[model samples]
Target chain A: MSDEKRYLKLHLIVLALVVIAELIGTKSYKLGPGTIVLLPMLYALLLGLLTGPKFLKIIDKEDMNAAEGLITVSVMLLMAKYGTNIGPTLPLIIKSGPALILQEFGNLGTVLLGMPFALLLGLRREAIGATFSIAREPNLAIISDMYGLDSPEGRGVMGVYVAGTVFGSIFFGLFAGFAATALPLHPYALAMASGVGSASMMSAAVGALVEIFPNMAEEITALGAASNLATGADGVYMSIFMALPMCEWLYRKLIRDRAEEVIKG
Target chain B: MKLSLKDPVVITVIVAILTLVGNFVGYKIDPITAFPGMLILFLIVIVGMWITKIMPGNLPAVVYVSLLGIILTMPWFPLGEKVAELTSQVNFLALTTPILGYAGISLGKDLDSFKKNGLRIVVVAIFVFVGTYLGSAVIAHTVLKLTGQI
Candidate 1:
């Protein structure tokens, strides 16, 4: 068989398996809302791991890239739907602008809080770039381009990027669900909390929120999407202009044994 | 004509069809009702992709599609109500499943890379997750308090 044919066959097989797994996992399992929300994702991850390099020959690098590309369509649709939902609530969403700004600060807070640990852990100065940024796909690209992927900073960023890509959704979903139920915060506030730039993580967090608050699902989703968009557009610039410098400054002040010089982007 | 899985055009078409079919089946919407919204979605995706190409920097396609969706469905626009009515029923949860599935699989494929980063990466990831979540939550809490939205 031609390579194309083989690739197509593998793609179809994996997709079929995934759909089946999702159906079975969701239907049969009587787990809690959080478990239910995460079931399909876990199933897919398990299937991929079983068929991945160390095990079988079902999926390869090329197939993975193709599958990743296909997800762009899903993301676009998800975001577009979010946009439509936000339409009716545009005025209210706008009025809640302070919350959105706060959300961005919170996103920045992650780097601020994470940087100290990264430096204390003896992570080189370059690692600060990756650790300080949001560590989404675009940030990964920017870091990789600025600091070669083989550099300590690149490794640090890629490590966070990979971890975020794999586990970010699950964490976000569970965290949002837990926060919504456990905390005194409003569901809409929790909803806005879901949008930390990564689309998949946002979806998972919103999904969990929907399970918890079905009536407010639309609002939660809209607010989450809007927050996500803001993070994506503004977060990048913020990371470059503000977050990176702040992290470097913190490292210099706090870390006594800082050897490597900070690479200004 | 031969279809190549590697061809982006072919991949896009396949994905579009699968998503449409998935939406209809998963959401159990009537084909007639779902068709218009699906068409609009497709147009939005295509246009979003084009916009991403021309736009400077790495502005995500989702941004454009969402922006466009917001604009088209805004109350001021003539077709806003109609478009909103048609697309409102498009259940996003059903749409997120397959995408998350793909993401899971892709993560598995990159397991080696993840392993290479070692356990310290896990620590960094934890901090990253905690910092972002807490930071955002604190801010959201304060704002909600000030605005009396909570």
Candidate 2:
């Protein structure tokens, strides 16, 4: 196939991957094989390869740059949904809310575990951007240009994002499992926790959690739906808050000075 | 095996159908139950893979499958009429959770290589996540509370 055809094909494949992930993760199958980790990663890797060369070229395109807008819409919608959903049960959800936020904090508390893994897992960072980009819109060309995923830093962070995605799932999944063992909490809490990053992964996490602990299955579904809406609503503002400083620090500490030296040459 | 997966059009057609079909079937099934929704999702994915001649891999794929299974299925599985009622009352979470996660992590992942400079970036992520969580939670709670909804 020609390059554009190939590119189009890749984009389509990525979309398919999303669909497949959505299907299997949303289902009730147990021990039938298939999990969340493989599908999306492969899709992302394929996306990266397809768009690697056009990364810079994509940046030059004008109307195609919808990164900011898309992210904003996605985040707001997610948060609004979450907030509105819990609006009725505010008292209970709030009583439980601190714990919910704390649970997230505890997961992040593992920054000790996460940092080293991130340092080594080169693809996670870019994958973070890529995954978000895809969620914003499946336009590979636009994502490539906006994030410059071809950059050394971009590549490095993609590694971190992928690793984070995997780790985040397992960590949260296991947390849910253990929590279920000890507490009166429900699986929705777990799914909500997992959905903290990628919806696809969160969907998978909720599916698995419900299957193993069939008792809490209902709670899990409610949480998953709630999680999606919550994240979608506040996601953009959160992104700006988190990404700006982190990217700045990474660029200054990792990418900038090196590029500066190259420029001087 | 690899050749089938490498085919882009095949992958796209397969996914689009699965997504539409899954959503359609998912809608048909009562989101209050788990089995039917889960089954439909599983069928779509496994069949999609089979038709595309691809197999599941380690880690990420496994997680994806497991997660998808739970998410799609739980909605349809009979979790008691309570779950059904509760979920319907709170379906807005569907949109918020995913959006926050996608954007938050997109930004969060940028933290990689940032640690090479020491604890500064990690500190930033901590503050950001905590601050945002609190900020959002406080605003959310206040709004709900003021409306006498809380």
State every prediction's TM-score relative to the real structure: 0.64, 0.37
> Per-residue lDDT for B7-110 in model 2, tens only?
43343333333333333332333334433432343343453334334544422122232233333324334543333243343222222222222222233233
lDDT of 2 by residue, A155-187 (tens): 333333444443434433444455445644333
**Model 2 chain B: ten consecutive residues of lowest lDDT:** B93-102
Pairs that collide in candidate 1 are A106-B135, A106-B136
Model 1 CA deviation exceeding 4 Å by range? A1-3, A25-36, A60-75, A97-100, A115-257, A261-265, B1-5, B24-26, B30-33, B56-60, B116-122, B137-150
DockQ of candidate 1 against the true complex: 0.41
Residue A149, candidate 1: C-alpha displacement in angstroms? 13
lDDT of 2 at A130: 25
What does fnat come to for each candidate?
Answer: 0.55, 0.04
Best by lDDT: 1
Candidate lDDT scores, in order, read 0.66, 0.36
